[model samples]
Target: MSETSSGKPGLTREQLADLSRHFDEDITFSRHIRAKVKEAVPGEATLYIDVQDFHLNGAGTLHGGVYASLIDNTMGLALISEVGVRTATIDLNVRFLGAVREGRVTCRAEVVHRTRRLATLEARVHDDLENLVALGSGTFRIFEKQGRPLV
Candidate 1:
């Protein structure tokens, strides 16, 4: 197998497409939040969600949990895109910096470091007006399932 920049097996474009499709179709919570894959490339992933009434908290702004979820999911995407391996978030940290009541919100994540069984990533969420809404970082445990496809 060809190696990626991270020295892991590289995935082809088709594999990446399938992975994104699986996330969009099979992940119920991501779809429930209206998150769509905007871009996915080795070491990076971008997702966007259109703000709706249901995504708001009691303060009429986007909920903190929503930001945390997006951060965790997007970082996972970044790691998988690079390594083409399965991973689970072991730790996630999010800091809400601003608020958004409506319009689109985008999250972009990038893999900052990686090892044989772990990856570290950072994500930022921005509102439609280009305001920084949240910042996050997470660590994921990488492992392969016995019979699952790597991608």
Candidate 2:
């Protein structure tokens, strides 16, 4: 549960792609939510998810659950990309400020703090037109990995 330098370093672009594949294929819940990594590197990650009709809430806006899940996933992926390791979510806090009936939702997460024992991350989700739809922050327990998260 640490971000020790001895654990690992950020992944290469190729590794990020492979990780994305594993995310889509191995994480069953992800198949339902379907967020894709647009960028992943040291200190930062950006992810995107398109709003399908199913993603809407009863009132016809993007579901609040979608905001929470995507923000958490994107923030966690940023840590994984930075450390080239896997992490378990310790806590995730989100605030939903706006809504969109349809279009792409993007999240950008960045490492806020990291140490041998813990890492903190922050993220914001925006609609295609740049509306601030959500805000999220998380703490995760980092782990040293022998390979990809699925491996």
Candidate 3:
């Protein structure tokens, strides 16, 4: 994929949305978590999930793995929307800022940088009340998708 004169991704927002919808259909864990693509534009994507009892930990709070998974997926979505290529996470750093027991959780991710084969993304998760709950950043190794999809 290439960038436009303004440095935005070549794909339009609608195109990104379509891609996200396809991902939501093809990815099982994403669907199982009920994560939905709220909006997508250029190098950024927003996803949200409604908290459920099953999403809670034994301590009755939002599980840390939920935050990690959302952050990972959100960041990958941002990079994929920007570059239109397959990527694998190289390193991910997540910080648990606050805890949430219920309500919608939204994650906003943006592509911070990219090169020929590497990209970096940052994401922030917020509760329905708009309080920052978690933060994440990751480096991804961009690569071409092979002939067939993974089984």
TM-scores of all models?
0.91, 0.86, 0.88
Better of 1 and 3 by lDDT: 1
lDDT of each: 0.85, 0.81, 0.82
lDDT of 1 at 92: 95
User: Per-residue alpha-carbon lDDT of model 2 for 1-151, expressed as tens digits?
Assistant: 2233545567766677777777656777666888877877667888889999989999999898989888888888788777776688899899989978989999999999999658999999999999898999999888766545632
Candidate 1 segments whose C-alpha is farther than 4 A from its true place: 1-9, 145-151
What TM value does model 2 have?
0.86
Tens digits of per-residue lDDT, candidate 1, 1-151, equal: 1465556565667777877886777788998887888887888999888999999999999999899988888998888887777788999999999999999999999999988898899999999988999999999998765213443
lDDT of 3 by residue, 25-101 (tens): 77899888888888766678888889999899999999998898899988888877776767799999999999999
Give the per-residue Cα lDDT of candidate 1 at 53: 95
Cα shift from native, residue 111, model 3 (Å) = 0.9
Arrange candidates by lDDT, highest first: which order? 1, 3, 2
User: Judged by lDDT, which candidate is best?
Assistant: 1
